[model samples]
Structures are given as C-alpha cells and as structure tokens.
Target: MTEETNGAAEPKAAAAPSQPVMQVLAQFVRDLSFENIVAQKGITNAAQPDVQVQVNLDAKKRSVENQYEVIMKLKVVSNIKDTQDPMFLMELEYGGIFHIQNVPDEQMHPFLLIECPRMLFPYVRRIVGDVTRDGGFPPLNLETIDFLALYRSELQRRAQAEAAAQTTPAS
Candidate 1:
C-alpha cells in the first residue's frame, strides 16, 4: 500500500453491524400450586397416566429503560390413561427480568415473548419436575417448546377474533 507524500496510510475498514444484546437480570417463580388428586382421594394408580400441558406468556416494559418483565404461565394436568380419573394438577407462573438492547423496534414484541421464555425454560422445567416428584409421582420432564410457532398461533388467534367481531351483526 502506498501512502500520500504528506499523509499517513489509509484508515481501517468500517466496523461490523452491532448484534442484539440480552441479559437476564433476574428470574423467579411468581406463583406455584400443586394438587395431588390421587393422594387426596386415596386412590392407587395401576397404569400410566395421561398428561397435558398448556402455556401462556405475557411481557411488559419496566419503568427502567431497556428493562422488561416476562411471565410464563403453565398448567399441567394428569389423569389415568384409561379411566380418565384426575391424578394431579400443577400450575406455575414463572417470570424473568431482562435487559435488552440493539433489537429493532418492530421485533421487540416477538423477542420478548419468544426468546425470553425460551431462555427461562430450563428453570421452569426443573421446577415442574421437582413439584411432581415431591407431590408423590415420578418426575415429569417437559418437552421442548416451540416459541416461534406459539407466537404465530397467538397472532392468528387474535386476527381471527378481530375478523369474527367485525362480521358480527350489532345487537
């Protein structure tokens, strides 16, 4: 590389684009409940039970700039596979405080609801397993969740509801 007679060498290349940043400021269980129906009713299990899980998510911006709180609510119900008798029920509200930066404004909603919960899933799973085992049943390991699909499904549900309302005749 050649330098000008009275000048220094060329300057360095432009820097790469900045990547988004996310940090978990804190994580905790906002609320938890477990009901052991089988134990309460004094029933014995003779076969494997059927289990179903449902999840809901919510996020809000905090008073502090760039900080947000995200909550994941989960409900698990287990019943006798054949008899359909209630076995146990569990509900947990887990939350995380996050500090996020560099994410585009248009993407913030998806980022908070999807990525934040994904980061907190491991802890939530551990809590569920422990609660089930301590409540007198084998530990239940949760299956991996698809946050992207969940987000899409929620959007579709809202759109359908809005369309239905628009089509409904005024009473």
Candidate 2:
C-alpha cells in the first residue's frame, strides 16, 4: 500500500438538528355575557335600549425552551339595566402555543402582540356573535378591528398627551 494514502483525513462534524418552528398559530373567543339595559317596570317599562358593546384585546407570552405561548384576551361590555344594576360584560381569553426557534428578535414582539391577537380576533368575533344571540338578544356582530392602527393611535395619543403636559405649566 504505498506508504499510506493522503496522511489521515479529518473527521467531518455532525450537522445540528433543525429546530421547531411555529408554522401556524391562531386564537378565538371562549366566553361571553349579555344583559338588558332597562328591565324595570311600574313607571314606564322600556325595552332594552342604549345597547353599547365595547371591545378590548390583550395578549400575553410565555417561553418554553425555544417555543412560546401566546394568549389573547377579548372583552365586550354593554350598559346597565337600571343604572342601579351591573353592567353587561363579556370576557374571553384564548391562547395557543407557538414554536419560534431562530426567529429574529425584532419581529418577535409584533408577532406576539399584534399578529397573535389578529389571528385570535375571528374566533373572538364568532363567540361574541353566538353568545349575544344565545343571550336572547340579536347577535352582536362586531366589525373587524385594525390592531396596528389602534396601537399606533394609542401611541400617538400618549405622545400628544405627554407633549401637551410638558408644554403646559403645571398646576
């Protein structure tokens, strides 16, 4: 064998396993509430009027290894029955687990806050519709929300307030 072939070859390094990734994740509403605004009688019995529904979206995150859990909180509210009665409030919180290994740091925040909630909104919408319909009132079909716009508006509002406060003389 001719004095040895090519001196000893170097061993090749093993390739690392591919980490998991969040291919798809979604959210939806899981609870609700409804109440008649004016249910009292004797004086002038009035059917439930002045119905108002307010919507709120919230998000939360938890990390496990390279994965994350994103939760969405959706809430709806309406006026009270007799002013002496409690307000009609419906709240639902849903969540999903997402694998986010190797994702860029900058995009993660928006993914958790805005994108996750956006995914969850449709589910939340259907739940609200069903709950209100089941609650004896017509389904309170909600319009789609623009989370990005809302977020930007909130930031702008805060900035304006801060600027105003700074410019104005303190009492």
Q: Provide the global lDDT of candidate 2 against the true structure.
A: 0.60
Candidate 2 per-residue C-alpha lDDT over 1-171 given as tens digits, one digit per residue, 9 for 90 to 100: 566678788787897766535644433334443543323322332335344544444444554465566665555665545553433456666665665665567667666666656766677778778877776566777788787876677668889999999999978
- As for model 2, its CA RMSD to the true structure in angstroms is 7.2
Which ranges in model 1 have alpha carbons more than 4 Å from their true place? 1-5, 8-16
Kindly state the number of residue pairs that clash in model 2: 3
Q: Could you give candidate 1's per-residue lDDT for residues 91-117 as a string of tens digits?
A: 999999999999999999999989999
Lowest lDDT block of 10, candidate 2 = 37-46
User: What clash count goes with each model?
Assistant: 0, 3
